[model samples]
Target: MPFVVPRSPELPAATWGSYGMTTLAVVPLIWRRRAPVAVLAAIVLIGGVYKVALDGPGQPLPYAGLIAFYTVALQCAPRVRVAVGLATVAAVALSVGWKTGTARELLFTLFVSAAAYALGRLQYTRQAYTEAVEARAAELERANRIEAEQAAARERARIAREMHDILSHAVSIMIVQAEAGPVAVRRAPERAEAAFEAIAETGRDAMAQLRAMLGVLRTAEASPRSPQPGVAELRELLERVRASGPRVSYERTGSVRELPAALEATVHRVVQEALTNVVKHAGASAVDVRLEYGAESLTVTVTDDGRGPGGSSSGGHGLIGIRERAAAHGGTAQTGPGPDGRGYAVRVVLVTSPQEVGT
Candidate 1:
C-alpha cells in the first residue's frame, strides 16, 4: 500500500523506504510494556532516520511515537518519565524546526503527546483503584464466612447441651422409677402403679421437649412455639425428681422478680443438670434447690446429701455445659463437697440484666 499525504514541495513523495521505516517504528511497540523507554527510543530513532534520510510522506498522526510515549508514561518511574519527557520535548522542537519551522504544528504535536500521557496515567489510577476495591471485598467475604462458621459452631454446642440435659435427666429418672416399679409391685401394688405412671410421664415430657427442638431444626410449620422451660417450670422438674425417691426441696430468697427468658431457661437447665448429677453419682436421699436473686445477679444452688463429688458427675459434660452457660451469661459455676463436706453441691451464679450478658 502507498503512503498518502498532500504533495508539497517540502514534503517528500511516498516510497518503499518510508513504508519500511513505519513498519520498523511500530514493531518495537510489541515490547512496550516490558521496556517502555527502550521502545520509545527505538520509535524516535527510526522516525528521525526516516525524516532526515528518506524524507518520506509525513504521517497524519505520529501513531507509533504516541503509543510508545503512552506506554512509557504508564510503566516508567517518575524520574525516568521526567527525563524522557524533557528529551522528547527537545526532539519535537528540533524536528519541527527542521521540517516546517512552525509554532502551530509544534504546539499541536505537544498537546497530542501530553494528552496520551494523561490518558496513560488516568488508566493506571483507575486500575489501582479497582484492585484496592476488589481486595477489600475479598477481605469482607472472608470475615463474614468466619463469623458464620463460628455461629454454626455455637449453635451446635447449644443443641448438644440441651439434648444431654433433657435426655440424661429423663432417662435417669425413668430408670430409677422402673427399678422401683418391680419392688413396689412385690410390696404395695398402689406404689407400683404410681412408679409406672411416673415413668410414663417422664418419658412424655422428654419426648415433648425433644420434639419441639427437632421441629425447629426441620423447619416444620406446626413446630411448637412454646418457650423453653423457665422458672415457672422448675416446680414440675423438682416433682419429677421427687417421684424418683429423692426428697427435693425448693427455696427462694431476695426479691423474687421475673427474669429474662434466656436467663430463666439457663437457670432451669442448671438446676436440672445438678439434680441429674445428684441422682446419677450421689447416693444421697435428700436434695435442696435454692434460687437467690441479688441486685444484678441470680444464684442457683443444688445441694444433695450424696457421697460427695465423684464419678462422671465431677468433671463431665454436664459440668462443662454449666460452666459454658454461666460464662455466656457473664457468670460462674463452682462445684465441690457441700457444707461440712457431707455431700456434693453445684452452684451457678448468672448475670440477670440483659445488658450484662456476654454475646
Candidate 2:
C-alpha cells in the first residue's frame, strides 16, 4: 500500500457557512449614526468572537471593526463615546489575546482604535463647518430682501410727493382763474381775457412739469439733468396760486438762503397744498403766506379769513398727504381754525440742517 498521509480534518459544511455569514455580519455597522450605541455594541459582541475563532488573534475583519468604532466616536455623546471606545478596545484586545496569547496583538488593536478616533473627529468637524456656512448664507439673503423692499417703498413716496406738488398747485389756480374769468369779463373785458390767458399758460406749464417729472420716473436711465425743483421756483409757484381767486400776499423773513433740493421741494409742496385747501374749503377773500428761514429749519404758514367749509377739520386726502410729506422729512404740520377765530390756517415746519434725507 502507498503511504498516504492522513488528510487534515476538512471544515464541515455548516462551519464554512457560519464563517461566510460572520464576514458579512458587520456590514450594518455603517448605519451606526441612526442607532449609534446599539449598532456599536452588536458589532463588537458578534464580530469580536467570530474573528477570534476564525482568524486567531491578530487580525479582525478590517473595514467592519474600523467603521463601527468610527461611528460610535463621532455620533455618540462624549460620555457614551468614551464608554463605547473602552468597550471596543477591551473586546478587540481580549479576542486577539485569547487566540495569539501575545502582547503584539494588543498593540495592533490599540493602533486601530486610535485611527478610528481621528477619523471620527474629522467627520464631526466637517459637519459643523457645513452647518455654519448654511446658516450665514440664509441670514444674508433675508437682509438683502428687506433692503430691497425698503428701497421700493422710498421710491413710491418720492413719486407721491412730486404728484402732490405739481398737481395741487396747478389745479387750484385753474379753479380760481376759471371762476374769476367770467366775473372780470362783465366788468373789465381786458382783465377777463388776461385771466383766461393766465389759466391756459398755467395749465400748459403744469403739464410740461408733470411730463418731465413722470418721464424721469418711468425711464430706467438717468435724465439729461436733475428734475428737482428748488426755492428759485417758489416765485413761479406763488404766482400760479395768486392767479387763483384768493387775494394772496407772500412775505419772506430771515436769510433767503438756498435750501436742500428735497427740503425746498417739500416746502414748496407744503405751501401749495395749504393754499389749495384754502381755495377749495375756505370761503375767504384774502390769504397770507409767510416763509421763515432759520439757522436750523424752515417754516411756512398759510392763513385765510374766510369761513371754512362746514365739516371736520380733516379736509380730505389732501390734508393727509401733507401730513405724510412733513413726517417723511422729520418735520411736522398742523391745520386747524385760524388763530383769530376767523378761518383755517395750515402751518408746516421742517428741520433742515446737514443730515441724510429719504433714507
Candidate 3:
C-alpha cells in the first residue's frame, strides 16, 4: 500500500527494507498464542527498528503489535503480564514522545492498548467460568446414575428373599402332609381327609402370594396390589404348620400394637422361615413361636425341641434371608441352640419406628 501511494515531502519514501520489516513484524503473530510475551517483544523490536533505521511509511494503527499484546494479556501469567505491560507502556511513551512530542497521541495509543487487554482478560474469565459449570453438571449426573443403580440392586435382593420364603415354607408343609396322608387313611379316614385338605390349602395360599408378587413385578400399574402377610397372619401360619404333625404354639408378650407394614411383614417372614427350618430339618415334636413387642422394638423368636443348630440347614438361603430382613430395619438375627441347649432357635430383633431405626 505504501508503494502504491506517494509519501509526504517531509517523510522518508517507501522502500523494500520498510516493507520487509513490516512483513516480519506481522509474521511472528502466528505463534502469539504459544509464546505470547515473546511474540509481543519481537513485534515491538521490529517496529522500533523500522521507526529508527528504515523510517517506514507509517500505519494508522499498529495492528500486529496490538494483537500480540492482547494475546499476552490473555495467555501469560499475572506476574509476566504485569512486567511486560509496564515495559510496553514505557516504550510506547518514549516512542510517541520522540516522534510527535504530543500527549494526545500517547494517551490515545495507551487507551486502545488498555481496551484490548481488558477484552482479552474478560475472554479468559468467561472461558474458566464455562469450564467450571460444565464440570459441576457432569459430576451431578454421575452421582444420580450411581444412586439409581444402587436402588435397583436393593430391589432385586428384596424380591429374591420373598421368593425363597414363600416357596420353602409352602413346600415343606405340603411334604409333611402328603407323607402323613397314607398313614392317616389306614387308621382314621377323617384325619386323612384333613391332611389332604391341608395340602390343597397350602398350595393355594402359596400360589396366591406368588401371583401377587409376579403381578407387581410384571406391571404394577395394571396389577391388583395385595397386602403382604403380617403379625396378624401368624396364627393361621401356625395352624398350617401344626396340621403337618409337630405341635406348634404362638405367644405374644409386651404392649401389643400395630407396627409399620414393612416391619410386620419382616416379622411374619422370619417366623415362617424358622418354622420351615424345624419342619424340614429338625425332627422336633413341639415348636414354639413368641413375639415380644417393646416401646420402640419388636422381637420374634422361634424355638423348637428338635435337633440342635446343626440339625436344620434351612437350605442355607433361608437363614441368610432372615438375617437380611432383620438388618433392613436396622435390626439383627441370631440362630443357635434353644433353652437348655435342647433344640435350635432363631431370634430376631427389629426396630418399629422409622425415626428410631439405626439410632
Model 2, residue 35: distance off in Å is 1.4
Worst 10 residues of 3 by lDDT: 52-61
lDDT of 3 by residue, 1-359 (tens): 66677767888777777777778889999999999988999999888887777776745249888898888888889999999889989988998999997999999999999988998899889988999999999999999999989988998999999999999999999999999999999999999999999999999999999988988899937554578899899999999999999999889999999887888899999999999999999999999999998888899999999878778754489999999999999999999999998898899999887687746
Q: Per-residue CA lDDT of candidate 1, range 293-329, in tens?
A: 9998999999988888664366479899999999889
lDDT of each: 0.88, 0.74, 0.89
Residue lDDT tens for model 2, 215-300 = 88788986674646666776777776666656788899997888777788777777777777777667677889898987777888
Residue clash pairs of candidate 1? none
TM for candidate 1 is: 0.90
| Deviation from native of the Cα of residue 155 in model 1, angstroms | 1.3
Model 3 alpha-carbon drift over 4 Å, by segment: 1-23, 53-60, 220-225, 313-315
* Best-first order by TM-score: 1, 3, 2
What is residue 279's positional error in candidate 2, in angstroms?
1.7
Q: How much is the lDDT of residue 166 in candidate 1?
A: 97
TM-score, per-candidate, Cα-based: 0.90, 0.83, 0.87
